[model samples]
Target: MAEPRVSGDVKAAFALLITLAALTSLLGVGALGWVVAPICIVLGIYCVLRAPLRSTMLTLMFFALTLENPSEMPAAGQWQSPFYMVGALLLTHFKTVIGGPWFFGGMDLMLAAAGVHWFVKLRGRSRGIPTPKPMIKLAHLCYATIAFTFVIGKLNGGGDSSMAVWQIDRVMYLPAVFLLCQAAFTQPKDYMSVGKVILVAATIRALISMYVRAIVPATVDPISGESDLPYTTTHHDSMLFGAAVVLIVALIIQRTGPKALRLAVLLLPILFGGMVANDRRMVWVQIILVFAALYLITEPNAFKRKLQRFALFMVPVGVAYVAVGWNQKGGAFKPVQIIRSAVDSDSDESTAWRDLENFNLIYTIRTKPLVGIGYGHGFWEVWPLPQVDYILERFIPHNSILGIWCYGGYVGFTGLTLLWVAGVYFGVRAYHHCKEPYDKAAALVSFGTILIYYVQCFGDLGLGTFTGVFLIAPSLAIACKLAVKSGAWPSALRPRQTA
Candidate 1:
């Protein structure tokens, strides 16, 4: 497929520029940084100046994965913790002066300081920080869709003002981070560095999960006398562990860099153990889908062919195991139990509720049908909803992809779908274009992460959350950037175009 460069990317660049400026200035980004957020700004500048690639490995966000987002009210997800962490240092939300309209927090300071560096370092470049053209356009489309939808919402008196704004803000994080990532990461080494950081952070998160699991006692159902492990981590950790497993496996498969197999062997077991300990059924589904997608994207080779034959041979045995183990009481068939819990809603209360919730979202779409009920509006429930402990049900759904279709209607859904599919498409193209083993491994990892992201979106509220945006946006950037480097796609550079 020909990856054509489009006109008006300059406009997109200008839009990003505007976003950065607006965030910094209008948000009072660092009005009181001297007292509270100095570390974040200093850290951002340090990363950019000292070693943009290496220094950013894990400073700002590793701690974020472990904590919840309480700095802001009605915490969206753990990913939101970064934005609130600065104020959270005092364990309090900054009043209107510091974190209010005139003040920004740690995350705000970091982004502002980093944006300044990005603009200065990549100054006067036409490649415009190496972003994909279509993504730039889609970012604009997303913002425009929000405007259109909000007008419809306001006219109809559709939803709560605050919830609507919160949803819209989360929606923008995807494209905004997409732009930031494209501009910030400048080379293959940057991707490799960031990937290593992700592995380390996620590995640590897994360890904490294991610790939590060990301490938390299982809750026995009063009626059935069945014990269930309390969820130790958020659903988003599944993405973290799943991506790590895939990346390490690819490294082992390709032997991409020095001591790659040794490194993979060291980390793979821990990540897998973490997944089992976390006890998320979706992890298995995501890993299976990501591995399958990775296989499809990669060029056929002797090892892959052998693996295919082995899989084919195991198909019958795998089926029989599932068939027999579906109802087995033995703990030896736990993997089957997990898989069964995913597909057979009767096996788990979580899955059963999701199924019922999905019906409500589907019914909502059926009624709205066209422009959606618009943003801020709650999905109309056709049936009584089972009470969930989660309070954000009206705004964010477990099946966020379905929620997008339910809330944004056809136009919004199409825009997001294009971005999602295009990410994998470009990732595959990058994989084929890269010649070096390391580059190939990087592309493969990025590709698998994006696929895992898809699973997260469907199985949980992954699409609009900060975790999903940050993960996918950066992975998407790596793929798009690598594709440009490998001459599979055009860069935004104005002068001597050489890949």
Candidate 2:
């Protein structure tokens, strides 16, 4: 007689059920507890099974949801809920990483996980894990400065709300994420996997955007004649999708996978349509700059052929855009018409407000050139409109470089600038060093992503916001890791090989 075997999946399911039963018995007394008990237990089991990868995936999912439904997600603090789940998981499985039992949890769990992983790796310094390079060291310093700046702001009665301070602190996770990549990623495929995950997330985001736009069509304001929906939010979503599109196109050119290329090509029009519908002038500028940079960086012959194919592919997209515009009265999808609409300073209040904002930020930076005003605090003395109550609530400069200068001071701004420079340097180095076509393409796309973000910083909030950090940080980390693995870094700084 054969004994029945319990598979790993069955064992996992049983363990989950037992855990849920125990949790329900102990804490599920009320109706609310009964509901929470099962959910918590399931998340606990999931964390135990996958640990940090699960954490990363959840983080990405949160971003995707936010992009898809920003208006809905923040209504009941729903946007921050995923972070709570991730925090709980990390705390429950603290033994898996170096850290243990953290109380203050949120997206900060990502930081804690990275910190613990780095601490454990420190014990194995002889095992070929290199010392932190100047760029990485500076990144750590920037993270510390961000924390110190927030504390100083709070102590000085600068910061308004506890939540605001927490929001600022979440950006600090960027440095920790970068450090985690150095430890976690050891090969080109690992880096490629990161890109694939991001692209898939973006694809989901695009679908969601299409769904939302379809369900809730933009309404026209009778007085202003502008669309009632928030264009900036849509533009930001489009930017994320645009970055994903660029990465995919670059990978396809690098010949990473024929199937991926085919799929990406199929989705190109959908993604581009979302961008056009968003109608952000700066986003369009960014798309152009990104493609231009990609063209310049890739091999000439390969780029030329790719461009010819792309031009032919875009003919249909051009016709579709024209048709979409034709459906609307007085709307034409000519390039000139779109560009003129974007730069219509007379009609565009947003652009006018941005100009004024930048002037005020620059004036404030002149006063405190060293460190600017601390976090959560804005310079209202120089505000153009002191009468408006909401004007006083303007904490960020709405421009990443200016925001850095205002919040972190000159030192912080310089540190951030150097971080971008380091990113580009590493990306280029990785591209040059990698032998395989696909690896080179990945490196090139990574470089383009950072470069595009840098260009985007001039007009929009760049690294200061979660969205900007989410888009750029992981790619930068992967680029740096790839550079290190390819021995593009100087020999003295290279990780030593252990017996």
Give me the candidate number with maximum TM-score.
1
lDDT of 2: 0.59
What TM-score should be assigned to candidate 2? 0.73
Candidate 2 lDDT tens digits, 1-499: 1212335663565467446544543442346443654464455344423444323433443443243232222212312222333223322232222234443432344455445644654334433324237656868776777776676567657577644453365356566556555544444466566666666666655665555555655667898777765442344554576677777787677777787678677777777766655555666777778887777766668659977799899999877775576434443545644454445544357666776777788887787778666776775547664244343235644566676777667766775567777888888888888888777877887787787677566766554444556666766776776677677876635445769
Q: After superposition, how far is residue 108 of candidate 1 from its true place, in Å?
A: 3.7
Clashing pairs for predicted structure model 2, backbone only? 371-409
Query: Can you write out model 1's per-residue Cα lDDT over 1-499, one digit (the tens) per residue?
Result: 1212223543344345334433443344455433434443443445444434223323433434444435323212312222333334322323443454533344544555555655676555544236667766876677788887777677767578767875676576666667667766765567776677678877876776676667666677899655565455666778878877887887776767667777777887778778877777788999998888778777788999999899999999999988999998648798888887788889877788888889999998887777787777877777778887766786788888888888878876876667667777778888898888878878888888888888888887776554555577778888888887787776543356589
Cα-lDDT of candidate 1? 0.67
What C-alpha lDDT, on a 0 to 100 scale, does residue 367 get in candidate 1? Answer: 78
Q: Model 1: what TM-score?
A: 0.81
lDDT of each: 0.67, 0.59
Off by over 4 Å in 1: 1-58, 61-105, 116-123, 126-129, 224-229, 491-499
